[model samples]
Target: MLEIKNLHASVLDIDDSEILKGIDLKVGKGEVHAIMGPNGSGKSTLANVLMGRFDYVVTEGDVLIDGNSILKLRPDQRAHLGMFLAFQYPAEIPGVRPWQFLKAALDSKADANGEDKMSVRNFSKLFDEKIEAVGINPNLVKRSLNEGFSGGEKKRNEMLQLEVLQPSLAILDETDSGLDVDALRIVAEGVNSMRSPERSFVVVTHYQRLLNYITPDVVHILVKGKIVKTGGPELALEVEKDGYKQYMAEAEVNA
Candidate 1:
């Protein structure tokens, strides 16, 4: 479970322009929430701030996971508390093989949970199973993480991390972008397989196409760094059909 209250965050320089203004959201276990917004609505900023990115300054309010404040925690500490953010654009880390990265992640998580470290052979078996489930080539495990990978491959790699890490709350920041229909299906399947009463997801996307694959329990429309409306899955269809014109008008009236 996660709760954000009156969150006012801003860039850390010059005028210190705020991007997330008085946000209030609650995500319970077994829930999927989709945030749909136009460009410059601060969706990505919310994701980064939740991950404890240093460039953003929190001017007010707090972020709590499982009833404890995490505003002061380091990025790794927040990660240890079962938070994962799949970026809109995954970075390519040269010289870091997928196997090595996964091993480190597994070990770190194991240490966090006070479990025994996994052996290389055992981890390889688990990795093989997950990679197969996500339909990723086993050969990719030997290559640098995301290096020279196709767009779909990169998205699959992020799903691979989702499967391996198994965090309690996964925030996917536009994972469907740049993905073809086949790739989107694969990614959606991967996410769906992980849905459980003990887990939740926050999917931030621009289009309703992704929602067709991963239906959210709630859909929120964000405007001008604030959530202007919240509704069920039907709202996604309405947005796709009529666009954000109505939502923008409502936002202007509220402003």
Candidate 2:
């Protein structure tokens, strides 16, 4: 469903310094791929570039959804084409209530896709149902988006967005980073519930704990801005047991 070809990106306006050297990956429909790597491996950079973050400039390569290139599309344009990125650090919108923010987002997507927006009555019913299913407090929706929310609450809110957005491809960048065991399980359950033949997930994490709950169809080791290894769930276990020292050295040698 998603393809990255020789993707090379650099932090814009910063000496043309490259972060992603040459990333090539393919994620098929109904597949979940986990990217595990050490810090400074450009894991999050790949996610941001996929989302068309302006701060990063893609000097080469193309990111495609389905088969068409999305290099020229803006972030929201990518969303219109069924791409979603759950931020590692969710931003707090001080004055935007969760209900308002989500409703507006869904409406915008609907409008962009030439569909009718959901009626407030109907939307409220569905929203509340998801809130219950995702185990988010209904009261949390009344507050400004992520404002004053605990780390777990923010992650829950991210899941709530995923549930409502229903994107074809979801790229979760370190969703389990700050979450405790309970929160991690909740987040994993939320993701697992969304898995299906038509949906795909690219879960970028540093540890294997999250993988325990949401087993990926494929696992990849990203090092020095490129994917050096791809394997099944067993690779994650190996990384957990032995660490990335070997991978790091191999990547340097290859470089």
> Which candidate leads in lDDT?
2
TM-score of each model, paired residue for residue = 0.97, 0.99
Best by TM-score: 2
lDDT of 1: 0.91
Report the lDDT of model 1 for residue 98: 91
Model 2 pairs in collision: none
For 1-255, candidate 1 gives per-residue lDDT tens digits of 999999999998837599998899999999999999988889889989999999999999999999999999988888888899998889999999998998998788789879899999998898898899889987876888999899999999999999988899999999999999999999999989999999999999989999999999999998888999999999999999998888888878887
Once fitted onto the true fold, the runs of candidate 2 whose alpha carbons sit more than 4 angstroms away are none
> How high is the lDDT of residue 140 in model 2?
86
In order, the Cα lDDT scores of the candidates are 0.91, 0.95
In model 2, the worst 10-residue window by lDDT is: 8-17
Q: How much RMSD separates candidate 1 from the native structure? A: 1.1
